[model samples]
Target: MLGKLKDLLFSASEADARAADHDDVAVAAAAVMVETATLDGTFDEDERASILGLLQRRFQLSDADARELLAEAEAEQQDTNELYAFTRAIKDHFDHDQRVEMVEMLWEVVYADGVAHDFETNLMRRVCGLLYVEDAESGAARKRVLDRLGLSS
Candidate 1:
């Protein structure tokens, strides 16, 4: 029936739109993570590996997919000096708890090299503000990450 065909087509397009939205969110998150890892003027293997693992865990991506995402995100991040676009995508897509988790993820990337530089810390503060995550919550997330990594906060 024409009606049935229309429904099928509409549903397929709707699903495609959702998939695209999901991909946008994923790329935005990965780009922010890449920035976090590289903000300290160094992009070492440990930071790359940490971002790869975090991307895998956060988005449930396979190794190959995560690597591809990392590459795409790095390119995207390099192309833009503004964090607003990436943060806007994240803020629009993620709920408050997820945003907090994002802050935690940034914290993880910051400590990937077993040290947190001033620039990285400043970046986190600005990101948290943009994401509307409160300072107390961001501090708590940082503490949790530090505790997990056996580091003193």
Candidate 2:
């Protein structure tokens, strides 16, 4: 019985590792979003909470899980050379409208602090391009986010 229990524990650990590997893309995307939200060197509490909330809602994750993913994402973002690694996974896994929604969500993060910085705007543009969202669609997404946030475009 002890041997069986040990085997079960080992299997569970392996499964957990595989699950983490599978979630790497989501973690990377979360990291990019967090990075963009903090582009101005000010990661306000509200903005951080908003990002955590979004991740929880979108990924169906618990607060702890979301935080863990965010931590992994933050580490990945630190060394990332381009947005392709994250965006490609999103493009492959999410539908077009979902991708568009992601763009809007990024815009929301940009606007969450009541101001959009140049770094944030440029990062959004680059991210949209990497996600294969057309310029027109990206603009529309921005507009949608502005409307949702009751901010002027």
Candidate 3:
């Protein structure tokens, strides 16, 4: 599974990306969460927990369901070539607030390690634009997460 994710996120082709449709919105969103968690090259326990918590709350799932979604997301993320397919599905299926909430989820993953790296923030920026999320909203979401985590922005 680790190797699959690395190959999907770190290396893939347009053909692989097009096949990303295998993932539904929840799975796609989970994939993006997984992507952010692994982007810093750690994939630490903290980030994993954050992703699980977010999936649970966002989808209102039981622990088992949440874990299943995460696993499915890991597989989906690993099978894809790009993030665009997921983002497009999300943008098409969800409303503006839901999209903003996703950005918030991404920020939570970014800060899961207690420190948001340059690459993480850069990924957040790109994802915000791809999802058509306004910069101000993304910043607000970041602040909300920081406040919840008791971290100073």
lDDT of each: 0.95, 0.83, 0.89
Error of 2 at 12 (Å): 12
Query: How many pairs of residues collide in model 2?
Result: 0
lDDT of 1 by residue, 1-40 (tens): 9999999999999999999999999999999998998888
lDDT ranking, best first: 1, 3, 2
Clashes of each: 0, 0, 0
User: What are the runs in model 3 whose C-alpha is more than 4 Å off?
Assistant: 1-23
True lDDT of residue 26, candidate 1: 96
Which digits, one per residue and each the tens of the lDDT, describe model 3 over residues 1-153?
A: 999987887566755655454338889899999988888888988998999999889978889989999998899888985999888888887799999999999999999889999989999999999999999999999999999999989
RMSD of 1: 0.8
Off-target runs (Cα >4 Å) in candidate 1 are: none
Scored by TM-score, the top model is 1
Q: Pick the candidate with the highest lDDT.
A: 1
Cα lDDT tens digits, model 2, 42-147, are: 8887787778888888888999998888778777877775677788877776678888878887887898887899999999888888888888998998888888
TM-score of each: 0.97, 0.80, 0.83
Q: What's the distance in Å from true for residue 45, model 1?
A: 0.8
